[model samples]
Target: MFGKKSRYYGLATVRNTDRQGRIVQAVKLRRLPAAGGVETVVTDGSQLDVMSEHQYRDGARFWHIADANSELEAGELVETTGRVINVPKR
Candidate 1:
């Protein structure tokens, strides 16, 4: 379960059986809102969580940055140093 401030918070979870016939609960997909943001250059050792904390004051919101930049993985987004990334406005 996600925290109150999490993007996935309060999303409906549906029960389903996987190919292996195991029951699982999955969160429903939710569309992200379109928003404008500013670009910032990442330095060596830069991390998405730190960047999120700096920009949004919530490290758990790093996915916002990833989503804004079309990155499906946070590691993929922050692994490259000196890369320009979008920091979405709250």
Candidate 2:
């Protein structure tokens, strides 16, 4: 159900029962990797995808930055201007 480049691709899935008592299959939670990255300052109106494009030449690779900093929500990385964020080295 996921593309080859998707982070969830090849991950194990588990059957889960929701409150309605229906069985649902869900991808296993992916753990954040212990990554070392360079510290980058968030510029005005900075965005994760844009930063990813600038750094990795692929906007879809924004997850690398998020995972590097252990942030579940990637947007959190660019929310504050001038804030220092970790950008994973490619």
Candidate 2 lDDT tens digits, 1-90: 689987788999999899999999988877766777889999889998988999899998998898888557788888888989899889
Looking at candidate 1, what is the lDDT of residue 73? 61
lDDT of 2 at 78: 87
User: Model 1: runs farther than 4 Å from truth?
Assistant: 1-6
Q: Give the CA lDDT, 0 to 100, for residue 77 in model 1.
A: 78
Which lDDT tens digits does candidate 1 get at residues 1-90?
Answer: 889987678999889999999998878755677668988888888998998999899998888888887666678877788888888988
What TM-scores do the predictions have?
0.66, 0.75
Residue clash pairs of candidate 2? none
For model 2, state the Cα shift of residue 66 in Å.
Answer: 1.6
Candidate 1's TM-score reads: 0.66
Weakest lDDT window of 10 consecutive positions for candidate 2: 28-37
* Model 1 / residue 86 / CA error / Å: 1.7
lDDT of 2 at 27: 88
